[model samples]
Every structure is written in structure tokens, then in C-alpha cells.
Target: MTIELYTWGTPNGKKASIMLEECGLDYSVHPIDITKDEQFGAEFLAVAPNNKIPGIRDTDTGLTLMESGAILLYLADKAGKLMPTDGEERWRATEWLMWQMGGFGPMLGQAHHFHRFNKGKADYAEERFLKETQRLYGVLDKRLEGREAIAGSYSVADVATWPWAARFEWHGVDLDQFPNVKRWYLAIAERPAVQRGYSVPSAQDIPMP
Candidate 1:
């Protein structure tokens, strides 16, 4: 059975879509326009009580899942790919995944919120978040040094972090400054599946209400 993916075009949503594409899973997308408050709708809330994008309903297991990181891990396990089953490699992949979920993602999100979305300039907040975002990017850049992918391979860690990193410019990141990350980013961006996944839910398909 095909998976039912509830998502949008944002980074979190792209995570699920990319994972599905990477896993070669058959799935259908249900676009959720969070900007229009569609995520809070009773129907969407049934599958995602948290009222967040990137939820999924796996018909094969009759399981409903939320949180982009969890969803990626679940899909990786379900497919028996994109993640090591056990060993240091497995833990390594998981470690970076957590780092992304707990640190990189949230920090960059706040940076984008303050720097781009804020109507009234919040100078202090913008500066704080942007600096933190840069720090996190620096960490990622160092980790990518002498490596092609996070956790040493293209695993769920890569899948989870790729979407957010793709918006580096929006987060005030200079690709030239983080050459290693830029290389990794460009490599991932060239994947056909990643390309298709990033294009999920065309902007014309979901109008803000």
C-alpha cells in the first residue's frame, strides 16, 4: 500500500518526501498549507495532533507518524536502507540526526524567522539567531571536512539535514566559506530523487487561504 504523506514545500516537509523518494516507496502527497492555518484543520489534526507539516500515514503498517526526524528514521527502518542496522555506524548516523533536529534546524529556523519573516526588525534576535546559525554551519562544515556525507555515509542523517542546509543562503550562509558543506550540499542537490522531492506540492497546487 502507498504511504499517505501530509506535507508542504517547506524544509520539514521536504525531509519526508526526500526520504520516501530515497527509499523508493510509493506514496501520495496531501499538501498542507500551514501559512493558511490548514494544519489546524480537524482532518489534518487527526493524523498529526501536533498540527505540524510532514506527517505520514503508512498504510502498510497502519501507523501514523509525525515529526520530520522520526518520520525519516521510520522510513529508513521500514525500507531497511539509508541507515545502518547496528554498530558504531548506526549510532553515528543517529548522533548527527539528533544534532540536526535539536540544534541546527531550530537555530536556523529562528534565524530565518527573525531575519526574513519579521515585519518589525528585531535586531538583537536577528543577530543572535544568525550568529548561532553560522556557528552550527561551521560545525557542519568541520564535520564534512575529509568526508562526503554526514555520519560518514548518505544515511538518514544526510536526508534529515539536507533540506535545511539547502536553504543556507536564506540563513545568510556563504557557500564559499563552507567549502566542504557546499560540496556535500551540491552533491545531494544533484540527486534526481532529491530534486523531485524538493519539488513536492507545487506552489500553484496549494494556495494560501
Candidate 2:
């Protein structure tokens, strides 16, 4: 059986879609336009009580999973390719995923909120998020200094964090200051699958603004 993926075009939603494509999994993408409040509807909220995109249902396992981190783990387990099976390697993968959830996710999310989504003078919010984001970027840069792909392998950890780091330019975070991170982000961003995942939606759905 196939998986049903309910998601939109945002970063969190794209995480699952990219994983699906990378794993060569058979799935359906349901575009939920958050601007029109589709994610808050009854049906969507049922699968995702928090009414968020990136929730998926596995027909084979009869499991409904939400959150990008959780979905990545589920798909990794299903694919048996990008995830480690035992020992410290497995824990390391899990640690990086948690880093995304706890560090990158929150910091970048707040940056987006204040920079793009703010309607008023939310200077404090913007500054706070940007500072936190920079700190997190430093941590990532240090981690990637002598390594490749977060955990020495191109696993879900890199996949999970790449989008967040990629958004730094959009959020006014200087990439030049962090050479290692810039290299890592650009390398992942240049991949064919990453390019394909970013182009999932049709031209008509794209906003002129």
C-alpha cells in the first residue's frame, strides 16, 4: 500500500515530500493552502491535531505521523538507506534530528515569523530570532568543519537541516560569515533531487508577490 501525504509548499511540508522522492516511495501529495486556512479544516485537523502540514498516513502500517522529524524517521526506517541501524551511529542520527526540531526549526521559524510574516514593527522579535539563528548557524558550522553531511554520511540529519540553513539568505543571515555552513548548504542545495523537490507545485499556484 501507498502513503497519503498531506502537505503544502512550506519547508516543513517539503521535508516529507523530499524524503518521499528520495526514498522512491509511492505516495500522494495533497496541497493544503495555509493562506486560505485549509490546514485548520476538520479533515486535516483529524490527521494532524495541531492542524499543520507534513502529516502523513501509511496505509500498510495504518499509522499517521506528523512533524518533519517524525516523518523523516518513519521514511528512513521504511527506506533502510539513510538511517543507521545500531550503536552510536543511530544515536548520532537521532541527535541531529532532534537538533533540527529543537534548534534550527525554532530559530528559523521565528525568523520567518518576524521577517516575512510580521505586519507591524516587530523589531524585537526579528532581532531575537536572528540572534538565535546566528548562534545555531555557528554550532552547525563547527559541526561541519571537518566532516561531510552532518554525521559523516548523507543521512536524514542533513536532509532535515538543509532547508533551514538554506533559508538564512532569505532571513538576512549572512552566509559569508559561516564558510563551512555555506559550503554544506550549497552542496546539498545543488543536488538534483533537492531541486526537484522545490519545484513540486505547478506554475499557476506560484504567487506573483
- Candidate lDDT (C-alpha), each: 0.88, 0.79
User: On residues 1-209, what C-alpha lDDT tens digit does candidate 1 reach at each position?
Assistant: 57999999888998999899999999999999888999999888989999989899999878998899999988998888899988998999999999999998888899889998992588999989988999998999999999998998799999889888878768878878988988888888888888888888773221111
184 Cα displacement, candidate 2 (Å):
1.1
- Residue-by-residue lDDT tens digits, candidate 2, 1-209: 48888888777876787788778888877778898999899878877888888788898988888888989999998988788888887888889989998988877898888877882578888888878888898899999998878887888898888866656765677788888987888787767767666555322121111
Clashing pairs in 1: none
Off by over 4 Å in 2: 202-209
Which 10-residue window of candidate 1 scores lowest in summed lDDT?
200-209
User: lDDT (0-100) at residue 154 of candidate 1?
Assistant: 94
> Evaluated with lDDT, which candidate comes out highest?
1
- Those runs of model 1 whose alpha carbons end farther than 4 Å from true positions after fitting are 203-209
